[model samples]
Target: MIRPVAVIGAGPFGLSTAAHIKASGIPVRVFGDPMVSWRDHMPAGMLLKSTPAASSIDAPRRGHTLADYCAAAGISRLAGVEDIVPVGTFISYGEWFQRELVPGLERVRVVSVDHRSAGGFEVELESGESFTARAVVVATGLSGLSHLPPELAAAAADGPAPTGPVSHSCQHHDLSRFAGQELIVVGAGQSALETAALAAEAGARVRVVARRRVGFGAPPWRQPRLRPGSPFGRAWSLWALSHYPQPYRYLPARTRHYLVRRVLGPLGAWWLRDRFEGKVRVEEIDRVVGAEALDGAPVLTVRTRAGATGRLVADHVIAATGYRVDIAAMGFLSHGLRTRLAVSRGTPNLGPGYVSSVPGLYFTGLPAAASYGPVMRFVCGTEFASPRLTRHLVAAHG
Candidate 1:
């Protein structure tokens, strides 16, 4: 049996966890290609909804901040309309951060994780190698399955999910693929609006579809009301997101769920009555309820608030519906280990410092999201999650 100090995914959260654990002088083994999903899955030309300062991951060393990297690259630390967080820029920063801080990433995909008899974990990878770690931290972000509405799902199975005709906002890589075709985008969150903009720029007849009319807003996460100046901020202790552990990191998943749905969710959608939609067609209060093959191409059956059904045919369909964290979907969570881990709302339950209810099984990144609010799901969330998680892991082993 191989038991390591820790195991983690290699996105910002995973790398940050490894960095903190390794920095504490503990032996850790982490798996996954660093930033592979971020580099590939996220659409280009999308600006981060949250600005740089509000979305910082924790940095153990003073100079490891994105601000520092920006300074070094002659990029402004401040991200404005002209300069936004490019996936490549953040991907490069993650790589540089890995090289500088978390050098333990194995650049391999973990296939399965099993439980050892002695209260430890066994991690098997795509390379057919195995590692034993006292603790295994699952940080695989966005690698979870992206779900589509029933209509879109049916169309995807019949053929290629619409290309220029329709596409899930999540699966799109190139807007040019929809060039010169009619497109209808679903959702009004940043992804939907941004993808709509991207498609329109590519010469496609683009229309945005949303269940409710959504107006774009500057992600209010940075507003003075949400920041340190507010008493609410002081109570939540989120003002130290870049430097300290999130207070919710230790709270129960149920508590966090309430906080997120009641607090963060409304706040996330409250901004943008008059931003981001520049000449884009937004079909407010519409939903895609069905998809049928119209002469071999997909046609979306649309339902509106008035209960009337209409159709929007495109060459493709892009579902920008957000991802869901089903514990059973994690590629590396073997049946044996998955059974052993505690469950919280269909996810592996985690505690403060990202400790799983199952000993030796910690979670980082998206897996920690329910308990950490929206914080653990973002790149910047790593900054807070790492040091707090590492301190406990290091103390236990070091």
Candidate 2:
């Protein structure tokens, strides 16, 4: 009997890949709470940066798009690039997709995955159940990869918590708890800007500190029409990056890494511009040099572009600095297996079909960004990743 393929996550990539694999008549086991990250890590009233047209999860069959979910659930239809998708609506869509297509998904945690001496992998779940799989796909998106700057890590010594003196933006699900408090949000990205806007709307006095000028994407109506549209945005470069990710792995390592980080860099959604401007204070600084807890409050020492230094104190400091993909941080992989895998800049070095150096071991989502370009970092990339990965699994193992 062929052992089932083990899918280690339940987000867009994992669910999409599982649906495709199962559609090909391959036995598979998917493990994780459906849309757990979008439901738990993000704030209650938050909106996705991706436009409605780019927010659907990839499925092997038709009628499983976000539009289908909205129509069936009686929610307002979302079709345009200008339409903003609420996190709640997207989560519900993901759950609906799971129910309709990937119904056998296991809502349990996979504790560890280790390679067997003979072949294949041994997967152990939190429930003390163990199983063997012909292959393993690690689609755990940004779960344990929150990147907190070293300057602010000391202030958050208590670790990331919603109510702590200093915390990462991913720690909060409800910004209402911070009402009436003073907040210092660090970063110019969507997460930082949107978190500041939400906190201010919740009655908190909010200020955003960034290393450079904050930027907002132009409204859909204002965008130039000459270039083709891709999930990242409308640009020839973005179009190529999103449509031809397979060639991305062939590029030099430095170029791939630089493009992944530089493309789609820190910028907020156009709709958020009105809510953020004038409502939240913005300060451009050289860098955050230090942070400390003083008198039960967080104080940040920052340098200016002009070489001047100053300190700012706030009731709480949020490090909305985003995530870094480090395979080592995925504690589910045993030390022996991790050291055997080839990685570049903390990301797995993936080949065709998103397979890593170790055979039968694959990664997708944020972790695949370095090898597959910035497209893998968004929900829309699953359209490219899922079908190709399914084909590889069927041809190799089936």
Candidate 3:
């Protein structure tokens, strides 16, 4: 009898890992819809921050790059940083990769994961089916992990679902729904900036509130130059971290945590700056100190950089504050199983090969960022994580 490895997502990291495992001749089962988050969560008309070459799902074999997708699709292939890749194109590329390499991927959701008495994991599906696997990779993307600030989170906790005035940016797909309404978007990151632009474009009265000033990414150079570095950023620290991910695992936890939080802190793409210049109102150096529901709308008390306090009322509040990895928040894990995994703060403390404290259970993607480095947060990280994890799985389980 052969025990297969179970992968819990079909996004870039999940697909990349699954393709590598399949190529390694190991039995693997991939669950979830391909590009589900990108397709469903993000508003239309968004562009990827990474360049075309870097925005690739690592194929066990060659020729599955984003450039290849553009060529095969009869679109002019992107050559340098000048060409921007849209989110829609990337979603199409992911689905294409799944079709070409990772076949028979189950689109069903894993409802629960419990440790078997003997060994391995018993995974129950939403379709009323169950199976045991030698290993399980919890690579589910940003779903169930959207982070809202304490004030907004408290207000959201009282709502039935995402219909509440206070909600995370992840809960929205189309900004057009907020047309002709007043909306306050929190955070200066790409998600916040872009969503604010989209909401304004969709006819919403929008204001962006952030604790710190905004920083936009540099635009592509008029003349393409070959500077060897990581796609993560132009900084040497980012370059080093992207190139040598394994060494990051050996760094002190404090250093690792600092890099994870600061290295990739909030910034919008250069192209988006023009959109927010005149259209969206930006309240920089201001933080949402408190939130309350008044007359069925969200009223936010904000503190300015100068220590002055003010209030702003909006029909909706979008918390683009980003995600925090909390192992206990994973609803699919049984209480007993969740308690068994080790964690530092909300993040799982992963060992080499991306294995968690619990044997044979693994974590990747954003959740792996704290342990593996900042690169784990992006699509390019899959290039490093997939092959290494595949080798580990093959040697240990195959």
TM-score of each: 0.86, 0.99, 0.96
**Residues 1-398, candidate 3, lDDT per residue (tens digit)?**
78889999999999999999999888899999999999998888888878886798889998898888888999888867667889999999999999999888999999999999899999999999999999999899898888777877655657423478798887788788899999989998999999999999999999999888877877766223455456854656777888888988788888989889888779988778888889999887556788888877888887888899988889989888898889878989889988998888788898878888888888989999989998899999999999988887777777
lDDT over C-alpha atoms for residue 26 of model 3:
82
CA lDDT scores, all candidates in order: 0.66, 0.92, 0.86
lDDT of 1 by residue, 139-195 (tens): 777775566667677766643343433455556677787788777777766677777
44, model 1: CA deviation in Å? Answer: 2.1
Off by over 4 Å in 2: none
What is the RMSD, in Å, between candidate 1 and the native fold over all Cα?
3.8
Error of 3 at 259 (Å): 1.1
Model 2: residue 384 alpha-carbon error in angstroms: 0.4
- RMSD (CA, Å), candidate 3 to true, equals 1.8
Candidate of highest TM-score: 2
lDDT of residue 111 for candidate 2: 91
What does candidate 3 score on TM?
A: 0.96
Model 2 Cα lDDT, one tens digit per residue, 21-130? 99999899999999999999999899999988899999998999999999999999999887889999999999999999999999999999999998999999999999
